[model samples]
Target: MRFLDPTKIAEVAAKFMELSSPCRLCPRKCMVDRISGQIGYCGAGSLPSHSGILQHFGEEPPLVGIGGAGTIFFTHCNMQCVYCQNFQISRGECGEFVTVEELANEMLKLQLFGASNIEPVSPAHQMHLFLEALSIAARKGLDLPVVYNSSGYDSLEALKLLRGIVHVYLPDLKYADSRMSAKYSDCEDYVEVARPAIREMYDQVGDLELDSNGRAVRGLIIRHLMLPNDISGTVETMYWIRDNLSSTVAISLMAQYSPIYEAWKFPELNRRVRASEYNKVVDLCWDIGLENVFVQELESQDLCIPDFRNEKPFSWD
Candidate 1:
């Protein structure tokens, strides 16, 4: 489907920016009037800001073909997880502020660099900014599939605005329990928010589709980062995806959780995930009839870790 049709660009851009003022961009609904320069719970301004962009190979196989997935990491996450891998970026420690014009240039830069697809990481809060950039990028001949990579806490209103714009959706079903969500990310109704948001994403992009090179062209890919001691509630999250959505949905079961940021302060999250924990969750995926699964090896912990402090958060190594 053709996204960012020139005729509809203005309408889409206006609606999404309005949400920033009331800031119902995510489940937080901080209502901080970002349009008038109020930084809400997400810690982002009216304009978009970014940490880094790279032709990343760290994503799922389909997203990381020979061309490499064009990954754009956005700063200041809506949810501040205690064990965030990219702690500095998530906490809004470092980034280069950019205008809508600059953001559009970055999207084109990724496509010009031979990226398979344009994946906007952590874009839930900046839908308006992304749409504005995508509209300009499309005019400049950026015809790659757009991947909406996010923390599953998106809003239905904002997602509805993205119906035709986004070709692929890669979202994390982080927590199944509100208590755990509140404890880890400080959002009590995370499950309430993420479930419907993920459902909306599935409705938009039904299933994973790949190009001739096995690179993702369009679809929804669910990412679940298993936390230590079952805190991530893998079983519950998996069951929801199967029972509520479908058993055939692509799942990227991540085992790369590292205790950075404030994780060391909490006993349960201070250490790495045990092999048994990862194995148990991997086994559960099969037991529950989750077919298209991408299971990472335990040793990939080191490989998957990223430090946003450096100029390139990810590397060729």
Candidate 2:
């Protein structure tokens, strides 16, 4: 469990803060001065805007241990995925802005409430704010492992700033083809950006490492959501992971793709992932000899989809 050195907090915070103004945090590079209240492609400013922070059990098994992952759902996203489950937050329609100190307090609260780890969802755009808050939290006895949960469109420059700061890297390798990504997520270069970003993450943390209690303390966990009509390119993604990265790299194969939000606009994406589709991806993983993989049930859509309007967004069985 390598934690950020408390002394290097200010130096790190400064490096990320510099990137925020020009807004080069993510690969989008919408160079609007966020520090001066200018909004960019992600629709984020200097302050961190978030929907909620709670013990979310709807994650991977290691992430959702007995205590559950302390997930801080940040508002806005670099890419506007058509079938986003948390459309309310990702579209920047709803959320409350919080200062660095307040965010730090929330991290401490999650730790006090017995969370396995501090997981920040969609954190690429708000890396500056998170690092500042995390530094404050670390100074105030917050010792939990930090999970850099992202959409995998992160810039290498921003990821370099998080080398020592982040313990667990949970990123989504959403697409293997650019055409699918451009049509669905509005990111033409998602595969190009995500590949190296994931590689950097794996280089930083290596394979997934679990603690004595089976909770993830450090490592990289790549999430691949199987989409309808093979839009997600599961076979290409699986082979790429095996050939490029190690076969031992952890993978969370999601079968919970529901046609929510703007997915209705696209006929091809307006349905759930079929059992056959899910099975094929799972079988492909085995065929490729990818060792560390976590699979979800095909009927997990209802449990996986979250409603941010409610106080408790997810339903636990």
Candidate 3:
């Protein structure tokens, strides 16, 4: 496992904090002065707020070996996806604010719990705080690979800072069309923003590299959740990946889209993904010569939708 030097971590953390005041941590560039308690588009403040930290088995198989991925569910998100499963935290309805030292201890605790990697879910907005905590934890012997789990609406500047710190990049490429992105996530520039950010991630850590036990230590895994009625633009997105990125780039084509949160309000998104829809996307992956693809069973919808209100957000059984 590679860890950033404490000095470099501090430098990156400082730069991120500077970005936070003007609040350009994400593409939104809300400029709300989060340091002064002003809420931005993401609803995140200066301090890092998180809902839970646990050993999560629902992640990709490589991320979850004998010891599960150490997932820290960060509160608030740059995008307000109508069908967000973990809306309790994403909507800023639930979370606990922690200082840099306390957050460092949490990372150390996860390491002690025998986690395969430290996964920070929806971390773009609170990355500075995470880095500060990581610096402290690294010094205290937190030697696990760091997974930069994101919603894919990341800013280039923020992703650039994470070059050395993040070992595995787990990002969701939600939509290929701007119209769908605008209607669903209120981000018309999501495709434009996510593409370059993902490219940068791949440049930083090329392809997925696993250890002797087949546990992912470094690489990029692009997750595309199959939505009902092709709202996610699966075909275009897959082609884009094949043409722009690589056919061999790992893709997790998810079938676990349950109509929760405000998804019921939209007629197009008011149901789970159909078997045909899932099959079409899966078949398309093969058709496009996407060699490294992970497909989920349609029944995973019932098992993967997490309720962050509970102690254990995910239930494997």
Candidate 4:
């Protein structure tokens, strides 16, 4: 990785640190001076705020073979989806701040624990922290690949810095319709923002590449969570991926949307995606000629969500 170059790492860290001061890390662009102790719309500050770090087996198959993906659940997010499974952390209601050095330590810890790759969950809002920690981690012999898992609402300027640093780009294409995004995630520009952002991510890392054992060594994984009543615009999203990126780009079609957090308030989002809804999207993906698509069963809502009230936040069986 270019980020491992001794000189490049320092320059990359310095480049992103400037963004945190004014906090232009995400598309929200609240422009609060996180360096001067102001909080931005993303809920992260100059320091890194993380909820938990562990080996996550719930990721896509390539990211989770025998060794799980090393997942560092970051504290806040740029978007506020009412049906978010991990709303407690995404809304900035949980987690604690860690120094950049400690962040490096955590990465190394996950590596020692036999994680296949390091995944920074909801990292769009805290790119500076991730880069800084990665610089230190690289110096300390952290050799695992990096996975940039995000909500898909990223700033192009921010994504430019991630070219050689990120090996696996896993982003959620939540909605193709801006109005639906506005209603659910409060991101009216989600389609406008995500389309280009995903294109950039794919440009950085092409279609998913796997090792001899089928573990992801590099490339992009597009995750589209199917919402009830066709609100997620899965058909439109699949078409966009096929046209904009490539048909071979890996897609994780999720049927695990559970009505959690504040989703009970929204009548349209108050239940799991129906079997018909999930199958329809999968069929359309095939029709779109997408080749590398992974699917979850229609009844995947039974998976347990780790309660942040305790030490563990989520688990997969």
Report the number of the highest-lDDT candidate.
2
Window of ten residues with lowest summed lDDT in model 1: 1-10
**What lDDT tens digits, residue by residue, belong to model 4 across residues 224-257?**
8888888898888888888878899999998888
Q: Once model 4 is optimally superposed onto the true structure by TM-score, how far is the C-alpha of residue 273 displaced, in angstroms?
A: 0.7
Can you tell me which runs of candidate 1 are displaced by over 4 Å?
1-4
My TM-score estimates for the predictions, one after another, are 0.96, 0.97, 0.97, 0.96
Ten-residue segment with the worst summed lDDT in candidate 2? Answer: 1-10
How many clashes show up per model? 0, 0, 0, 1
Q: How well does candidate 3 score on lDDT at residue 312? A: 71
Ranked by lDDT, the better of candidates 1 and 2 is: 2
Residue pairs with colliding backbones in model 4 are 306-313
* Model 3: residues with Cα > 4 Å off, grouped in runs: none
Question: Judged by lDDT against the true structure, how good is candidate 1?
Answer: 0.86
- Pairs with backbone N, CA or C atoms under 3 Å apart (clashes), candidate 1: none
Residue pairs of candidate 2 with colliding backbone atoms: none
Superior candidate under TM-score, 1 versus 2: 2
Give per-residue lDDT, candidate 2, residue 268: 92
What ordering of candidates by lDDT runs from best to worst? 2, 3, 1, 4
